[model samples]
Target: MGLGGTAKKIQTLAEKAEQTYQRLNDLREEVEKTQETVTETGDRVRQLETEMAEQRAVLDAVAEEVGVDLEAVSTDAHITEAESDDEADDAGDDGSADTDGDDEAVDDDS
Candidate 1:
Protein backbone atom coordinates (compact mmCIF):
# COMPACT_ATOMS: atom_id res chain seq x y z
CA MET A 1 0.00 0.00 0.00
CA GLY A 2 1.05 3.60 -0.40
CA LEU A 3 2.33 5.50 2.67
CA GLY A 4 -0.64 7.92 2.46
CA GLY A 5 -3.13 5.01 2.50
CA THR A 6 -1.39 3.48 5.55
CA ALA A 7 -1.48 6.83 7.38
CA LYS A 8 -5.21 7.23 6.63
CA LYS A 9 -5.87 3.71 8.00
CA ILE A 10 -3.95 4.47 11.21
CA GLN A 11 -5.87 7.72 11.71
CA THR A 12 -9.20 5.93 11.27
CA LEU A 13 -8.26 3.27 13.83
CA ALA A 14 -7.13 5.92 16.29
CA GLU A 15 -10.43 7.76 15.96
CA LYS A 16 -12.42 4.57 16.60
CA ALA A 17 -10.35 3.78 19.69
CA GLU A 18 -10.85 7.27 21.07
CA GLN A 19 -14.64 7.01 20.60
CA THR A 20 -14.67 3.64 22.35
CA TYR A 21 -12.71 5.03 25.29
CA GLN A 22 -15.07 7.99 25.65
CA ARG A 23 -18.12 5.67 25.64
CA LEU A 24 -16.56 3.46 28.31
CA ASN A 25 -15.83 6.47 30.55
CA ASP A 26 -19.41 7.73 30.13
CA LEU A 27 -20.77 4.30 31.06
CA ARG A 28 -18.59 4.18 34.18
CA GLU A 29 -19.85 7.58 35.29
CA GLU A 30 -23.50 6.52 34.77
CA VAL A 31 -22.98 3.38 36.84
CA GLU A 32 -21.41 5.38 39.67
CA LYS A 33 -24.35 7.86 39.71
CA THR A 34 -26.84 4.98 39.77
CA GLN A 35 -25.05 3.35 42.69
CA GLU A 36 -25.05 6.61 44.67
CA THR A 37 -28.78 7.09 44.10
CA VAL A 38 -29.51 3.54 45.19
CA THR A 39 -27.53 3.93 48.39
CA GLU A 40 -29.34 7.17 49.27
CA THR A 41 -32.72 5.59 48.61
CA GLY A 42 -31.84 2.62 50.80
CA ASP A 43 -30.87 4.91 53.68
CA ARG A 44 -34.15 6.86 53.37
CA VAL A 45 -36.16 3.65 53.40
CA ARG A 46 -34.41 2.46 56.54
CA GLN A 47 -35.03 5.77 58.28
CA LEU A 48 -38.73 5.70 57.44
CA GLU A 49 -39.03 2.12 58.69
CA THR A 50 -37.37 3.06 61.96
CA GLU A 51 -39.69 6.04 62.42
CA MET A 52 -42.74 3.88 61.79
CA ALA A 53 -41.57 1.36 64.39
CA GLU A 54 -41.05 4.08 66.96
CA GLN A 55 -44.53 5.53 66.34
CA ARG A 56 -46.09 2.09 66.72
CA ALA A 57 -44.33 1.59 70.02
CA VAL A 58 -45.56 4.95 71.31
CA LEU A 59 -49.14 4.11 70.33
CA ASP A 60 -48.89 0.75 72.09
CA ALA A 61 -47.60 2.39 75.26
CA VAL A 62 -50.39 4.99 75.23
CA ALA A 63 -52.99 2.26 74.69
CA GLU A 64 -51.67 0.39 77.73
CA GLU A 65 -51.70 3.50 79.90
CA VAL A 66 -55.31 4.24 79.02
CA GLY A 67 -56.45 0.68 79.87
CA VAL A 68 -56.94 -0.12 76.22
CA ASP A 69 -56.05 -3.59 75.00
CA LEU A 70 -54.74 -3.19 71.48
CA GLU A 71 -55.53 -6.83 70.66
CA ALA A 72 -59.18 -6.31 71.61
CA VAL A 73 -59.66 -2.91 69.97
CA SER A 74 -59.54 -3.99 66.39
CA THR A 75 -62.68 -2.48 64.87
CA ASP A 76 -64.08 1.05 64.58
CA ALA A 77 -67.55 -0.10 65.61
CA HIS A 78 -66.35 -1.45 68.95
CA ILE A 79 -64.46 1.78 69.66
CA THR A 80 -67.50 3.87 68.87
CA GLU A 81 -69.75 1.84 71.15
CA ALA A 82 -67.25 2.04 74.02
CA GLU A 83 -66.97 5.82 73.59
CA SER A 84 -70.75 6.24 73.53
CA ASP A 85 -71.17 4.24 76.73
CA ASP A 86 -68.52 6.29 78.46
CA GLU A 87 -70.19 9.55 77.44
CA ALA A 88 -73.61 8.28 78.62
CA ASP A 89 -72.20 7.37 82.03
CA ASP A 90 -70.43 10.69 82.35
CA ALA A 91 -73.61 12.63 81.52
CA GLY A 92 -75.62 10.64 83.99
CA ASP A 93 -73.19 11.29 86.85
CA ASP A 94 -72.49 14.95 86.14
CA GLY A 95 -76.00 16.18 87.15
CA SER A 96 -76.56 17.20 83.54
CA ALA A 97 -79.57 14.93 83.09
CA ASP A 98 -83.08 16.38 83.15
CA THR A 99 -85.02 13.66 84.93
CA ASP A 100 -87.93 16.03 85.21
CA GLY A 101 -88.91 19.34 83.57
CA ASP A 102 -87.98 21.25 86.75
CA ASP A 103 -84.27 20.45 86.44
CA GLU A 104 -84.23 21.67 82.82
CA ALA A 105 -86.00 24.94 83.80
CA VAL A 106 -83.39 25.54 86.54
CA ASP A 107 -80.58 24.97 83.99
CA ASP A 108 -82.21 27.36 81.48
CA ASP A 109 -82.02 30.34 83.88
CA SER A 110 -78.26 29.81 84.35
Candidate 2:
Protein backbone atom coordinates (compact mmCIF):
# COMPACT_ATOMS: atom_id res chain seq x y z
CA MET A 1 0.00 0.00 0.00
CA GLY A 2 2.78 2.44 0.85
CA LEU A 3 4.59 1.74 -2.47
CA GLY A 4 1.41 2.37 -4.46
CA GLY A 5 0.87 5.70 -2.73
CA THR A 6 4.43 6.82 -3.48
CA ALA A 7 4.07 5.89 -7.18
CA LYS A 8 0.85 7.88 -7.50
CA LYS A 9 2.44 10.99 -5.95
CA ILE A 10 5.39 10.70 -8.37
CA GLN A 11 3.04 10.49 -11.32
CA THR A 12 1.16 13.62 -10.23
CA LEU A 13 4.36 15.61 -9.78
CA ALA A 14 5.57 14.62 -13.23
CA GLU A 15 2.34 15.76 -14.81
CA LYS A 16 2.54 19.13 -13.04
CA ALA A 17 6.13 19.59 -14.19
CA GLU A 18 5.13 18.92 -17.77
CA GLN A 19 2.35 21.47 -17.57
CA THR A 20 4.74 24.12 -16.21
CA TYR A 21 7.22 23.47 -19.04
CA GLN A 22 4.50 23.85 -21.66
CA ARG A 23 3.36 27.15 -20.13
CA LEU A 24 6.94 28.42 -20.16
CA ASN A 25 7.32 27.56 -23.82
CA ASP A 26 4.13 29.39 -24.65
CA LEU A 27 5.34 32.48 -22.82
CA ARG A 28 8.65 32.36 -24.71
CA GLU A 29 6.81 32.27 -28.03
CA GLU A 30 4.65 35.23 -27.05
CA VAL A 31 7.71 37.23 -26.04
CA GLU A 32 9.38 36.45 -29.37
CA LYS A 33 6.31 37.62 -31.29
CA THR A 34 6.20 40.85 -29.34
CA GLN A 35 9.86 41.51 -30.02
CA GLU A 36 9.33 40.97 -33.73
CA THR A 37 6.45 43.43 -33.77
CA VAL A 38 8.50 46.03 -31.98
CA THR A 39 11.37 45.60 -34.41
CA GLU A 40 9.10 45.94 -37.42
CA THR A 41 7.50 49.07 -36.01
CA GLY A 42 10.88 50.58 -35.31
CA ASP A 43 12.05 49.86 -38.83
CA ARG A 44 8.98 51.48 -40.32
CA VAL A 45 9.38 54.57 -38.21
CA ARG A 46 13.00 54.90 -39.25
CA GLN A 47 12.06 54.54 -42.90
CA LEU A 48 9.48 57.31 -42.61
CA GLU A 49 11.98 59.56 -40.95
CA THR A 50 14.48 58.98 -43.75
CA GLU A 51 11.85 59.68 -46.38
CA MET A 52 10.83 62.92 -44.69
CA ALA A 53 14.41 64.07 -44.61
CA GLU A 54 14.81 63.27 -48.30
CA GLN A 55 11.66 65.16 -49.16
CA ARG A 56 12.91 68.15 -47.30
CA ALA A 57 16.15 68.03 -49.22
CA VAL A 58 14.31 67.84 -52.50
CA LEU A 59 12.10 70.77 -51.52
CA ASP A 60 15.13 72.84 -50.63
CA ALA A 61 16.80 71.99 -53.91
CA VAL A 62 13.77 72.92 -55.91
CA ALA A 63 13.33 76.16 -54.06
CA GLU A 64 16.94 77.07 -54.76
CA GLU A 65 16.65 76.15 -58.41
CA VAL A 66 13.56 78.27 -58.91
CA GLY A 67 15.06 81.24 -57.01
CA VAL A 68 12.36 81.17 -54.39
CA ASP A 69 13.11 82.99 -51.22
CA LEU A 70 11.40 80.77 -48.68
CA GLU A 71 11.62 83.39 -46.00
CA ALA A 72 10.05 86.15 -48.11
CA VAL A 73 7.46 83.88 -49.71
CA SER A 74 5.34 83.83 -46.60
CA THR A 75 5.13 87.65 -46.48
CA ASP A 76 4.95 88.71 -50.11
CA ALA A 77 3.20 87.74 -53.33
CA HIS A 78 4.56 88.53 -56.80
CA ILE A 79 2.72 89.13 -60.06
CA THR A 80 3.68 87.47 -63.33
CA GLU A 81 6.11 89.26 -65.66
CA ALA A 82 3.43 90.13 -68.25
CA GLU A 83 1.03 91.52 -65.71
CA SER A 84 3.77 93.61 -64.10
CA ASP A 85 4.92 95.04 -67.43
CA ASP A 86 1.37 95.94 -68.41
CA GLU A 87 0.71 97.66 -65.13
CA ALA A 88 3.94 99.61 -65.41
CA ASP A 89 3.16 100.61 -68.99
CA ASP A 90 -0.31 101.75 -68.01
CA ALA A 91 1.06 103.80 -65.16
CA GLY A 92 3.49 105.54 -67.54
CA ASP A 93 0.72 107.40 -69.38
CA ASP A 94 3.23 110.07 -70.61
CA GLY A 95 5.10 108.63 -73.62
CA SER A 96 8.36 108.51 -71.68
CA ALA A 97 9.07 105.03 -70.25
CA ASP A 98 7.88 102.52 -67.68
CA THR A 99 9.12 103.23 -64.18
CA ASP A 100 9.92 99.54 -63.64
CA GLY A 101 13.34 100.16 -65.40
CA ASP A 102 12.36 98.87 -68.88
CA ASP A 103 13.19 102.13 -70.73
CA GLU A 104 12.75 102.30 -74.51
CA ALA A 105 14.96 104.52 -76.66
CA VAL A 106 13.05 107.64 -77.61
CA ASP A 107 13.98 109.84 -80.60
CA ASP A 108 15.07 112.86 -78.57
CA ASP A 109 16.80 114.32 -81.69
CA SER A 110 13.39 114.79 -83.37
Candidate 3:
Protein backbone atom coordinates (compact mmCIF):
# COMPACT_ATOMS: atom_id res chain seq x y z
CA MET A 1 0.00 0.00 0.00
CA GLY A 2 1.08 3.62 -0.52
CA LEU A 3 1.90 6.10 2.30
CA GLY A 4 -1.45 7.85 1.58
CA GLY A 5 -3.33 4.58 2.24
CA THR A 6 -1.41 4.03 5.48
CA ALA A 7 -2.17 7.58 6.63
CA LYS A 8 -5.86 7.09 5.80
CA LYS A 9 -5.98 3.89 7.88
CA ILE A 10 -4.29 5.67 10.81
CA GLN A 11 -6.77 8.55 10.57
CA THR A 12 -9.68 6.11 10.63
CA LEU A 13 -8.26 4.38 13.67
CA ALA A 14 -7.77 7.71 15.49
CA GLU A 15 -11.37 8.72 14.76
CA LYS A 16 -12.65 5.38 16.15
CA ALA A 17 -10.46 5.83 19.26
CA GLU A 18 -11.84 9.33 19.86
CA GLN A 19 -15.43 8.09 19.50
CA THR A 20 -14.75 5.25 21.94
CA TYR A 21 -13.21 7.66 24.46
CA GLN A 22 -16.26 9.96 24.29
CA ARG A 23 -18.63 7.01 24.78
CA LEU A 24 -16.59 5.85 27.79
CA ASN A 25 -16.80 9.33 29.37
CA ASP A 26 -20.53 9.45 28.71
CA LEU A 27 -21.00 6.00 30.32
CA ARG A 28 -18.95 7.06 33.37
CA GLU A 29 -21.12 10.14 33.85
CA GLU A 30 -24.28 8.04 33.61
CA VAL A 31 -22.90 5.55 36.16
CA GLU A 32 -22.07 8.35 38.62
CA LYS A 33 -25.56 9.83 38.23
CA THR A 34 -27.14 6.43 38.80
CA GLN A 35 -25.02 5.90 41.92
CA GLU A 36 -26.12 9.29 43.31
CA THR A 37 -29.76 8.38 42.64
CA VAL A 38 -29.36 4.97 44.35
CA THR A 39 -27.72 6.55 47.40
CA GLU A 40 -30.54 9.11 47.70
CA THR A 41 -33.16 6.35 47.36
CA GLY A 42 -31.44 4.26 50.05
CA ASP A 43 -31.35 7.24 52.45
CA ARG A 44 -35.02 7.91 51.79
CA VAL A 45 -35.89 4.26 52.44
CA ARG A 46 -34.04 4.37 55.78
CA GLN A 47 -35.87 7.55 56.75
CA LEU A 48 -39.22 5.95 55.86
CA GLU A 49 -38.34 2.83 57.87
CA THR A 50 -37.52 4.92 60.93
CA GLU A 51 -40.84 6.77 60.60
CA MET A 52 -42.73 3.48 60.31
CA ALA A 53 -41.05 2.12 63.47
CA GLU A 54 -41.96 5.26 65.38
CA GLN A 55 -45.57 5.07 64.17
CA ARG A 56 -45.82 1.41 65.15
CA ALA A 57 -44.48 2.14 68.61
CA VAL A 58 -47.10 4.86 69.16
CA LEU A 59 -49.88 2.58 67.85
CA ASP A 60 -48.79 -0.23 70.17
CA ALA A 61 -48.83 2.13 73.18
CA VAL A 62 -52.29 3.39 72.26
CA ALA A 63 -53.59 -0.13 71.79
CA GLU A 64 -52.23 -1.06 75.23
CA GLU A 65 -53.96 1.93 76.85
CA VAL A 66 -57.21 0.97 75.14
CA GLY A 67 -56.92 -2.64 76.31
CA VAL A 68 -56.76 -3.93 72.73
CA ASP A 69 -54.86 -7.18 72.15
CA LEU A 70 -52.45 -5.80 69.53
CA GLU A 71 -50.82 -9.14 68.80
CA ALA A 72 -54.15 -10.92 68.32
CA VAL A 73 -55.45 -8.06 66.22
CA SER A 74 -52.36 -8.19 64.03
CA THR A 75 -52.74 -11.95 63.58
CA ASP A 76 -56.41 -11.61 62.72
CA ALA A 77 -55.66 -8.84 60.25
CA HIS A 78 -53.03 -11.02 58.53
CA ILE A 79 -55.44 -13.95 58.40
CA THR A 80 -58.20 -11.79 56.95
CA GLU A 81 -55.84 -10.38 54.33
CA ALA A 82 -54.69 -13.86 53.35
CA GLU A 83 -58.24 -15.13 53.12
CA SER A 84 -59.25 -12.16 51.00
CA ASP A 85 -56.30 -12.66 48.67
CA ASP A 86 -57.09 -16.36 48.34
CA GLU A 87 -60.71 -15.61 47.50
CA ALA A 88 -59.66 -13.08 44.88
CA ASP A 89 -57.22 -15.51 43.32
CA ASP A 90 -59.84 -18.20 43.22
CA ALA A 91 -62.35 -15.86 41.66
CA GLY A 92 -59.85 -14.80 39.01
CA ASP A 93 -58.90 -18.43 38.33
CA ASP A 94 -62.41 -19.36 37.10
CA GLY A 95 -61.62 -18.43 33.51
CA SER A 96 -58.01 -19.64 33.29
CA ALA A 97 -58.26 -23.34 34.22
CA ASP A 98 -55.01 -25.19 35.23
CA THR A 99 -52.68 -23.35 32.86
CA ASP A 100 -50.37 -21.66 35.38
CA GLY A 101 -47.96 -24.61 35.58
CA ASP A 102 -47.97 -25.08 31.82
CA ASP A 103 -47.29 -21.39 31.32
CA GLU A 104 -44.34 -21.54 33.71
CA ALA A 105 -42.88 -24.51 31.82
CA VAL A 106 -43.28 -22.71 28.52
CA ASP A 107 -41.58 -19.63 29.95
CA ASP A 108 -38.67 -21.78 31.14
CA ASP A 109 -38.32 -23.30 27.69
CA SER A 110 -38.21 -19.84 26.15
Candidate 4:
Protein backbone atom coordinates (compact mmCIF):
# COMPACT_ATOMS: atom_id res chain seq x y z
CA MET A 1 0.00 0.00 0.00
CA GLY A 2 0.97 3.65 -0.54
CA LEU A 3 2.36 5.64 2.45
CA GLY A 4 -0.56 8.13 2.16
CA GLY A 5 -3.11 5.32 2.30
CA THR A 6 -1.42 3.75 5.37
CA ALA A 7 -1.34 7.17 7.12
CA LYS A 8 -5.06 7.80 6.42
CA LYS A 9 -6.02 4.32 7.74
CA ILE A 10 -3.99 4.88 10.94
CA GLN A 11 -5.69 8.25 11.45
CA THR A 12 -9.18 6.74 11.04
CA LEU A 13 -8.36 3.95 13.51
CA ALA A 14 -7.01 6.48 16.05
CA GLU A 15 -10.18 8.60 15.77
CA LYS A 16 -12.40 5.56 16.28
CA ALA A 17 -10.33 4.45 19.34
CA GLU A 18 -10.53 7.94 20.88
CA GLN A 19 -14.31 8.07 20.41
CA THR A 20 -14.66 4.61 22.02
CA TYR A 21 -12.50 5.72 24.95
CA GLN A 22 -14.60 8.86 25.49
CA ARG A 23 -17.82 6.85 25.41
CA LEU A 24 -16.42 4.33 27.92
CA ASN A 25 -15.33 7.17 30.25
CA ASP A 26 -18.81 8.75 30.08
CA LEU A 27 -20.48 5.39 30.83
CA ARG A 28 -18.15 4.82 33.79
CA GLU A 29 -19.03 8.25 35.24
CA GLU A 30 -22.75 7.57 34.86
CA VAL A 31 -22.39 4.23 36.67
CA GLU A 32 -20.57 5.98 39.53
CA LYS A 33 -23.35 8.57 39.82
CA THR A 34 -26.01 5.82 39.94
CA GLN A 35 -24.08 4.03 42.71
CA GLU A 36 -23.94 7.22 44.79
CA THR A 37 -27.70 7.76 44.39
CA VAL A 38 -28.43 4.16 45.48
CA THR A 39 -26.22 4.58 48.55
CA GLU A 40 -27.98 7.81 49.52
CA THR A 41 -31.41 6.22 49.12
CA GLY A 42 -30.41 3.27 51.32
CA ASP A 43 -29.17 5.64 54.04
CA ARG A 44 -32.43 7.61 53.96
CA VAL A 45 -34.50 4.41 54.25
CA ARG A 46 -32.45 3.28 57.26
CA GLN A 47 -32.90 6.66 58.96
CA LEU A 48 -36.65 6.56 58.42
CA GLU A 49 -36.83 3.03 59.85
CA THR A 50 -34.96 4.15 62.99
CA GLU A 51 -37.24 7.16 63.46
CA MET A 52 -40.33 4.96 63.11
CA ALA A 53 -39.01 2.51 65.69
CA GLU A 54 -38.35 5.34 68.19
CA GLN A 55 -41.84 6.79 67.71
CA ARG A 56 -43.39 3.37 68.24
CA ALA A 57 -41.45 2.93 71.48
CA VAL A 58 -42.63 6.33 72.75
CA LEU A 59 -46.24 5.49 71.93
CA ASP A 60 -45.97 2.13 73.74
CA ALA A 61 -44.60 3.87 76.85
CA VAL A 62 -47.37 6.47 76.79
CA ALA A 63 -49.99 3.78 76.38
CA GLU A 64 -48.60 1.96 79.43
CA GLU A 65 -48.55 5.16 81.52
CA VAL A 66 -52.16 5.98 80.62
CA GLY A 67 -53.46 2.52 81.65
CA VAL A 68 -54.34 1.76 78.06
CA ASP A 69 -53.60 -1.76 76.90
CA LEU A 70 -51.84 -1.21 73.60
CA GLU A 71 -53.26 -4.34 72.05
CA ALA A 72 -56.82 -3.46 73.11
CA VAL A 73 -56.47 0.14 71.89
CA SER A 74 -55.07 -1.03 68.63
CA THR A 75 -57.94 -3.49 68.13
CA ASP A 76 -61.58 -2.74 67.24
CA ALA A 77 -62.93 -4.32 70.46
CA HIS A 78 -62.74 -1.02 72.39
CA ILE A 79 -64.91 0.70 69.82
CA THR A 80 -67.36 -2.20 69.74
CA GLU A 81 -67.87 -2.16 73.50
CA ALA A 82 -70.92 -0.02 74.29
CA GLU A 83 -71.30 2.16 77.39
CA SER A 84 -74.25 1.54 79.71
CA ASP A 85 -76.80 4.29 80.48
CA ASP A 86 -75.82 4.18 84.17
CA GLU A 87 -72.18 4.60 83.29
CA ALA A 88 -72.99 7.57 81.05
CA ASP A 89 -75.06 9.19 83.81
CA ASP A 90 -72.24 8.77 86.31
CA ALA A 91 -69.73 10.22 83.84
CA GLY A 92 -71.92 13.33 83.26
CA ASP A 93 -72.76 14.11 86.95
CA ASP A 94 -69.33 15.12 88.33
CA GLY A 95 -66.74 14.35 85.58
CA SER A 96 -64.82 12.79 88.47
CA ALA A 97 -66.07 9.37 87.47
CA ASP A 98 -63.96 9.41 84.32
CA THR A 99 -60.76 11.04 85.61
CA ASP A 100 -60.72 9.45 89.05
CA GLY A 101 -61.37 5.95 87.76
CA ASP A 102 -58.66 6.33 85.09
CA ASP A 103 -56.09 7.53 87.63
CA GLU A 104 -56.99 4.78 90.09
CA ALA A 105 -56.85 2.16 87.40
CA VAL A 106 -53.42 3.22 86.32
CA ASP A 107 -52.17 3.31 89.91
CA ASP A 108 -53.63 -0.10 90.64
CA ASP A 109 -51.91 -1.61 87.58
CA SER A 110 -48.55 -0.23 88.71
Residues 1-110, model 2: lDDT tens digits: 99999999999999999999999999999999999999999999999999999998999899999998976764444445667877886776575453554445343322
**TM-score for each predicted model, relative to the true structure:** 0.60, 0.54, 0.82, 0.59
Q: Model 3, 46: alpha-carbon shift in Å? A: 0.9
Model 3 Cα lDDT, one tens digit per residue, 2-33 = 99999999999999999999999999999999
Q: Please give, for residues 3-90, the per-residue lDDT of candidate 4 as tens digits.
A: 9999999999999999999999999999999999999999999999999999999999998998988887766565555445557755
Worst 10 residues of 1 by lDDT: 92-101
lDDT of 2 at 60: 86
Candidate 4 minimal-lDDT segment of 10 residues: 77-86
Residue 105's lDDT within candidate 2 is 38
lDDT tens digits, residue span 1-110, model 1: 69999999999999999999999999999999999999999999999999999999999999999999787777777899999998996677555465664766766765
TM-score of 4: 0.59
Off by over 4 Å in 2: 63-110
What are the lDDT figures for the candidates, one per model? 0.88, 0.82, 0.89, 0.83
RMSD (Cα, Å) for all candidates, in order, is 18.3, 23.3, 5.2, 19.2
**Prediction 3 TM-score vs. true:** 0.82
- Top candidate, metric TM-score: 3
Itemize residue pairs with steric clashes in candidate 3: none
Q: Which portions of model 1 show Cα errors greater than 4 Å?
A: 73-110
